[model samples]
Target: MSDRAAAFHALHRPGRPLLLPNAWDHASAAALAACGHSAIGTTSLGVAAASGKPDAAGATQDENRDLARRLRELPVLLTVDVEGGFSDDPAAVADYVAELAALGVVGVNLEDGRPDGSLAPTELAAAKIAAVKAAVPGLFVNARTDAWWLGVPEPRDEALRRARAYREAGADGLFVPGAPDDAVGLLAAQAGRPLNVLHRPGGPGLAELGRLGVARVSTGSLLFRAALGAALDVADAVRAGREADLPDVPAYGWVQELTERFRTDGHR
Candidate 1:
């Protein structure tokens, strides 16, 4: 494994979960790295929305690639969310991920949720995972099943079943987003790999998730949505002539300096 891939894999330790924040662009990623985030992921929704396209509909493959290229210059490990691998064909999915790996991405999140609100076949998902691992053995493949996210019947059973298949297919981690707090430990214990859960606000904190045997906790699109909401709230407050009640915002010069350093230094 490459050193970056090894470092990223080492971050997924049970009982000491890595809180991974997803960034939408170079500025957000550079800022996160500036704040000492050793690793950062790209949010598919954020990337698509920023490019005036839809998320999870295979509309942002090029956009994702471009973003990955930009983020490669940052001093942080990057894991991209390539929704459905941007294709159904296993070989195509593998090729796309291989390109990302070539650009220095250490990991990727490949989900089974389709754009039509239906889960892809379990075998197909497993095939994608297997293909990706075969193509880039060092790339950490976080195989995500949307049984819970899609509100399928008996999600726990479905998730576990899929988890077993993905594990057999060489998945490095199992991501069951929308799995409830009650079901986390069970999934973690039985998934046979590092368990990754999406972070839900007002839900169990990171410490609690670590105790539940979760190795990685991803913010997913939550940070992007929260950022949009905050921007709208600030705009509304300013329009209503009210002081924006917000945390300390980064100064304009600070952001410029952040990007400028990356531009000149190439990579930290």
Candidate 2:
């Protein structure tokens, strides 16, 4: 495995889960790295929305690739979220992930959720995971099942089935977003791989998730949505002639320094 890949894999300790924050663009990623985030992931919704396109419909392939290219220059590990691998064909999915690996990306999150809110066939998802691993063995593949996210009937049973299938097919980790807190330990114990859960506000924090045997906790699109909400809140406050109740807003120069350091040193 490459050094970056090894480092990323090492971060997924069962009792010390990695709190991975997802970023949308270069500024957000660099700023996160500046704040000492050793790894950063791209948010598909944020990428698509920023470009005025719909997310999870394979509309952000180019946008995702561009952002991945830009983020490779930062001093942090990167993992791109290729929704449904951007295609149904396993070979095509493998090729797309191989490209990201070539660009120095250490990991990727490939989900089974379709644009129509239906889950992909378990065999197809497993095929994609197997194909990706065969193409790039060193790249960490976080195989995501949307059973819970899609509100399917008996989600826990379906998630467990898919998780086992995915792991058997060479998935390095299992990501079941929107998993209920009580069921987390069950999934983690039986998934036979590192369990990754999405961070829900007002839900269990990182320490609690670690205790539940989760190896990775991703923010997913929460950060992006929160950022948009914060921007709108500031705008509304200013329009109403009220002081913006911003919290620890980054200075303009500080933001500029992120770009400046990249320009001068080529990386943080």
Clashing pairs for model 2 are: none
Against the true structure, what is each candidate's TM-score?
0.97, 0.97
Worst 10 residues of 1 by lDDT: 259-268
Error of 2 at 29 (Å): 0.2
Candidate 2 global TM-score: 0.97
State in Å the error of residue 35, model 2: 0.3
State residue 23's C-alpha deviation in candidate 1, in Å: 0.3
lDDT of 2 by residue, 96-115 (tens): 99999998999999999999
Go through the candidates in order and give the clash count of each: 0, 0
Off by over 4 Å in 1: 264-268
Each prediction's Cα lDDT score? 0.94, 0.92
Tens digit of per-residue lDDT, candidate 1, span 126-212: 999999999999999999999988999999999999999999999999999999999999999999999999999899999999999
RMSD (Cα, Å) of model 2: 1.6
